[model samples]
Target: MPAPKNPLLPAVRWALAVLAGAVMVLSFAPFGWFPAALASVTAFYLLLPRGRRGGFATGWFYGLGLLGFGVFWIRISLNEFGNMPAVAANALMLLLVAALALFYALAGWLVTRLRPGEDAPRWWVGPLLVLPGVWVLLEWVRSWLFTGFPWLFAGNGQINPLPLLGAPLAGWAPVVGVHGLSLAVALSAGLVVVALRRGGGARPAALAGLLAIWLVGALLARVEWTRPADGPLSAAVLQGNVEQSLKWAPDGVLPTLEIYLDLTREVLADSDVIVWPETAIPSFLHEVEAGLLPPLTADAVAAGAEIVIGVPIMEMAERYFNGLISVGSAADRYYKRHLVPFGEFLPFDRQLRPLIDWFDVPMSSFSRGEAERPLLQVGPYRVGVSICYEDVFPEEVRQALPEAAYLINVSNDAWFGDSLAPHQHLEFARLRALENGRPLVRATNTGISAIIDHRGRVTASLPLFERGVLTGTIQPRTGRTPFAAVGSLPALLLAAAMLVAALLLGRSRNTAA
Candidate 1:
């Protein structure tokens, strides 16, 4: 019982574990190369022995590798935006990464405990179903708990090019969210590993299967997920390229209004609607009604177009909302329900008011929006809109679907500067397009303003921080995806069933013993 020591084995295991973690991190891009490669290495590492007690350590190392490498940008936000110094920012980010890594630790424990054995009652089913089930559970916890960081939710990485035929089915994520997709990706990777371990021609078959899957994906991509329905409508997305420092400043107000109007005027002739970046006006709508709104609306209407711009709207005594306004077409507004913690409004700002200036945002307090509203009608078409960070959550977009033919997203990416954050953010929106089977027209203030088709391809896009527009005909979509209708419920139910089955199987095995 002296542990049947194998020194070389321990060293090799540690090295492989570290390498595996590194591979997982490498999937984050710029930070590492080839996510699929790193994912393969990670799949291999997860197969290593942990001997029960060592499971925690194995998981922690794996998490440290996964989050430590993938979320390095957290430090960028803390230092550059939060005004923290490099060391403190790095430490805080590391602590967060470490905390998130615990989920991986939990994942390890579950994986080990749930491994199907010869005597297990549901041994035949456990490997296929139970493993993926637990993965969905852990990923769900990661998404919802702690106000939900939901970044790197596994399936998010699979977007268009991958054979992840499961993307459209995952439309339910808005209601249930990222956990479902994570389960599918984890399960797929797990299947790949299982195929490899069984050896022989299975490896080749699996490889061939993966290649075929990608081919199928490419072919599936050919299918028009959403079609140009009804009459065609022209729209223009106004890119202010407003620098973060001056966006909210008082003097910055006039320049911001001017830039938007100038761009609106330029694109107005060819468009039925023109959109401005999130909170483009910077000033509250009521305050600017006399000076800004009237002229913008009149111009848009007179020139046969509508303007949907982001601005601050006031309600009640002092309540303010980050709102989307329709100036010409319907004269309507949609408030942003999903607020950015600390950036938009501090979570515990009552106690953290003094620290507010640290975030460098003057007006950090804005109330959330209410239930879903009808799509804003401009010209002949009704457009559904989600502002800024709203596009990240699929549920928000689905709320406007069927009612709205085109999905419009307006954002200000000035804060992220030249970081992978914008690309990652755009990828999330693209996935939303694929999942929802809708055309997404994203208009960002600083960069990555893009036109995404139902297939999630960046059909047309403008370079970041450049002050210009890319005009394109957006194909309209009508039908709803399973994800769009039922949301994350399907995935959650599947995960729950897996857990229940695992428990029952374990009990039955004990009874047999």
Candidate 2:
């Protein structure tokens, strides 16, 4: 893929790789330039070394650009909300970005090692098979590694359809899941390489295949994976634009609670389920269990409504968890199954806890909740509930489906301030709703709170950092999507197969030579 040997050729390649990766970030939410996904991938794939230069360096630089620009919001959270020094926050953000970039580094290294010395690898062998296979498998690995930061996935951009195609690529979510789209996105990149490097037949074939992939996603858009279980449930998501600094303040806690109560009381008469943003109550569940919650529960019951709210709760004195609880219709409670690393709990608690004062941010020491906890029962529907970061994981969301009539995710986006995070966070929840064939109710502190339908369409929403009650109707659906029933196994298996096929043929080619 490199040009003629020259002094600046290597530097140029690396620069292009970095720039291409950054271009990929433009495809993601807040930017929503969908075609940039293909252009970025095409450039990155072509920039990959076909000669002696290592692809690993190219890949890491690419990752640095992609993740660096995409998740720069991390610095905002650390500095603005966590009170971390700006310099320290930037350093920590760089540290995380560098560490995660190793996955891409590994992907590039493996692609080179798999089929060495190939200037133009066969269309079926390397371009279509090995590249996408290795790329998305690494994405899967990245999703679960170190409790997963599944942010900035390429598929996140495809939540909307390609411009000319006029089809939502996210339609594939219900079948292959997000990683499948990752694979498809990677394969689309591979197609570009095939078209560029190969002659005659391979070029047309690659172009046709690329069109067909998006065409298939467009066609899949029509399939109804789940049917309605009940009539629309009138829901209200209470978005209290509480400042992160004052949320847990010694004096501001009660007033924050009062803000939600007043908002809920106003909307209860018009809704069946009233939802509050994450940690809207800014206090321990036990501390309020005796006094504040009882009255709130009584109010909801008297008004024929149920309220779902997020709060930190303690059990047995030592076990603290970020929790979600329903009051009035059901006393059901659910703890956040997946806790954010360093944000919710320290990674190496015994050592890391005392070494750094930064990790001591409020509500950072909570323990993980049970994975099989009971669902939040809201009136006649059982809701799949998640807190903050949990909605980003596709499998985690799938685990609650078919049985869960709908999904509710409560988050505190105030941590990220005015950043791309709140917008990107909404896209993931939108994809999950499509993947599982369920309507999603997302209530957030400092907005972009939305009600997404089963088709991954944002039906109604509140703007970022707004103070209001979002009253929307959620049509609960029942039945499983192919993805909901099988999880991500199909996508994983498909990627694994492509990889195995490439490696075996490469082994034979080496043996014959």
Candidate 3:
């Protein structure tokens, strides 16, 4: 139902729209929206009023502001690589933002309909179960719908120093999965707004509840979910920082190979395992192994270390794959299951052939590896590894968890330059570490290479875009966290159940009224 149009209401509506935008911006504040729980609550409150469909307008505006700020770097890709005229690029970019904003619109609409009253009986239940349930449900839906852009789910905001104990108990951090802790944070934020307006002593109770959540996380952090299965393992991660310009040029092959081998040989004395960023080999694996096989294997064996290098594998009949190969003793091979649509392999490559070449896709036609593959074992550790774009997806990494002692991701973000892509990517890896309760070792082509502990803290790192190696002794843990054992099923099921209950409760209340 539309309220009769009031002349001054448009101004008020505009102000609310701007406030919604501010809330979205605050969602990415330094400490994160989770801690303050401000943005989530504001979003809920703004959309809760009856007879006012402000949710759509408010959500769309906020999304425009949030995406415009968070993913502003898309222009770099569109203008620099897509080669679109400015007007066309901005319009397309806005279209993406608008589409993403629809999820928020859905969130707002769900909350409003679930408001407790004569029409809806489960208003209270909405916060208890429906809020977290629907929110996570939407996130999960978004992750797969339209090929997914599961970037920075509300959960990612709860990373580190935030008492992420729920991460291990829930089998993954709420931030890492669709439901988990991040939904819990949103529920709490809504509760906070509800309490504040009621003008009661509930504020203390809310604050205490918030404290308890963090306390639980702190307690869980103390527990070492895993331990060294046998002994210490040493590994070297190579950061080539090769210029994006020459990395794929035919002339870049020899220099790229030489630089990696040179660095590998230098660090061979110190590390038990050596790693290179995704596609560090430049040329296809089968093509380069002829030249790299003999000496590199001998050197690894001599150093008692395994060499894990990222390369492109072109199979018979021109099927290509982004993969990692382990050389020396205990060596095994693993291919990336999740591939980047536009970057690694174009979705519709044949139709987009000219567009692909324009984007400078080095080897853009890679095939996907099996959904399930064995972990790559290096010495005492069974490594669950993901290549390049795989890290962005938390669920995809779980397929490797049971057999793997840790998570290793190798990427080449030279494509994204020094933009927020690298930092944002690194953050995703950290959340994955926390979610799975596994130490994550990430090696990138041009900087932001890091070693993240099970608690999602960076223990060691090498500068981005610099030619060097990160050498560290990492202990492999044995036990599995709740996440490692079950994945997102628990969260998804919970969300589904909440939605069902909300509907039933709403129906029951309407009948009673």
- List clash counts for every candidate, in order: 9, 0, 10
Cα lDDT tens digits, model 2, 33-126, are 8778878877876777775357799888888889888888899878877778889999999998988888877877777667545443443566
Q: Tell how far residue 271 is off in model 2, in angstroms.
A: 0.2
- CA lDDT, candidate 2, residue 210: 88
TM-score, structure 2 vs. true: 0.96
Error of 1 at 271 (Å): 1.4
Task: Please give the lDDT score at residue 17 for candidate 1.
Answer: 57
Top-TM-score candidate index: 2
Q: Stretches of candidate 2 above 4 Å error? A: 1-8, 116-124, 162-164
lDDT tens per residue, model 1, 69-110: 666776776677667788887888899888988887787777
Candidate models: Cα lDDT each? 0.68, 0.84, 0.69
TM-score of 3: 0.88
Better of 2 and 3 by lDDT: 2
Sort order, TM-score high to low:
2, 3, 1
Better of 1 and 3 by TM-score: 3
User: How close is every model to the real structure, measured as TM-score?
Assistant: 0.86, 0.96, 0.88
- Best of the two (1, 2) by lDDT: 2
When summed lDDT is taken over every stretch of 10 residues in candidate 3, the lowest stretch is 163-172
RMSD of each: 4.3, 2.0, 3.9
Candidate 3: tens digits of C-alpha lDDT, residues 350-372: 78777535555567667888846
